[model samples]
Target: MQPLQNAGYDRAITVFSPDGRLFQVEYAREAVKRGTTSLGVKSDEGIVLVVDKRTSSKLVETKSIEKIFQIDDHIGAATSGLVADARSLIERARIESQVYKITYNEPIRVDNLAKKICDMKQLYTQNGGVRPFGSALIIGGIFEGESKLFETDPSGALIEYKATAIGSGRSDAMDVFEDKYEEGMSLDAAIDLALDAVYEATEGKTSAESVEIAVIEKDTEKYRKLSQEEVSSYIDQLVEKKSNDEEETESEE
Candidate 1:
């Protein structure tokens, strides 16, 4: 009998198909691609993380859907893909940070924490019986007085970025960043750019309640989430600017 199409290559996480591809890992990446949009921007002043909660119903509490997490005083993460899997990975990250601090009497470096998480992710891909985590993380923080941003995928690959986005709206968000991102931007400018990216990613469907924002300031080294009111003000500003720009185009015509 002829073998089945794909020859069951994707049946196990440990299996690798010809041309050096792991189908299971790629499938996990697809889970991330289908998740809600999340992005991170790094500037000299700090790092900004923005996520679209995309609450579907009014009955659901906006606060209950958390796509951002604080792993340490200086470290924060934004996630896309399976939220449960993201939470599990976050819990492990928190533990790793604490353990490192207790053992070394100093907070773990941002890169080190990212590597630990990626190591665990890599392990699952090489082992059988367990599936890879269907999530990707955009981790940002202050390390040695410097701001850093890192992105990790389900396949254990890690990349550092000045600004990056993941999930279903990644392309839209990235298009904005590629055009506008600049180095040495102030924290306020970073926040504005991040909000703009989120707005583009969501196709202007975002509201203060359906979005979350966080920042890790380089000087303070503290992670903080912007209050709903602050988020609202920013959203209003962006909306008004967009409206005004449209009006100008109409006048030119």
Candidate 2:
């Protein structure tokens, strides 16, 4: 196709170089890793999405910067990477959800919606006219009393995770998920786990002011992004939980 950015491997997204790598897709993945970390956890009761929302500049409209969005009454997404690209994808998802309902007169399944957006992402790679989205989408939703969570990447691969972390410090976040994730966890436990994952990712950089939390509970209303006070309360509770656990460990020792 056109001249690549990296000269050798970085060309069309579909073209694999001699190394058998799609450099453009890798670049998109790297772009995602540069963003503030976002976490998603699914429990029996519901799903939780947590995001570290550090702005680039004081001039940036803090009020306008949101990493989590309500895709439909039942589905929501937490995004990382190019914020604009994520916004476009989120809007597309919203429209797709509406279109699906209008066509079938029923809510689209969470898995189906995830695949639809991912397939749309893959389309850009096949055509030289466009570039893959430099973003990762973590969608969490409840459909028919079952909670589901999924993460999708620039290469259009969709993966389901009981708990998933994307963007910066994902490796650290994953460790937490591996340790704490349990089947049929309560909403509070899932939220605590999500908060702990974010803490690991940010190395404690996150705070009520710099982070946002959202949840889609058993209620039928929709995804609810927590306010500053709500986030602070969660943080406070998490701190207390950790403190109690440590004290118990010391006592046992």
- 1-253 in candidate 2: lDDT tens per residue? 6455536656443577765777788889999999989999998889999888888787886667899999999999999999999999999999999999999999999999999999999987778768889999999998988898999999999999999999987999999999889998998899889999988788866667777888898767368878888889999887787779889999999
| Candidate number achieving the greatest lDDT relative to the actual structure | 1
Candidate 1 C-alpha lDDT tens digits along 107-173: 9999999999999999989987999999999999998889989999998999999999999999999
Give the top-scoring candidate (TM-score): 1
> For candidate 2, what is the total of clashing residue pairs?
0
TM-score of 2: 0.90
**Relative to the unseen true structure, what is the C-alpha lDDT of residue 62 in candidate 1, on a scale of 0 to 100?**
84
- True lDDT of residue 23, candidate 2: 75
In model 1, where is the ten-residue run with the lowest total lDDT? 1-10
Listed per model in order, the count of residue pairs whose N, CA or C atoms clash below 3 Å is 0, 0
Off by over 4 Å in 1: 1-5
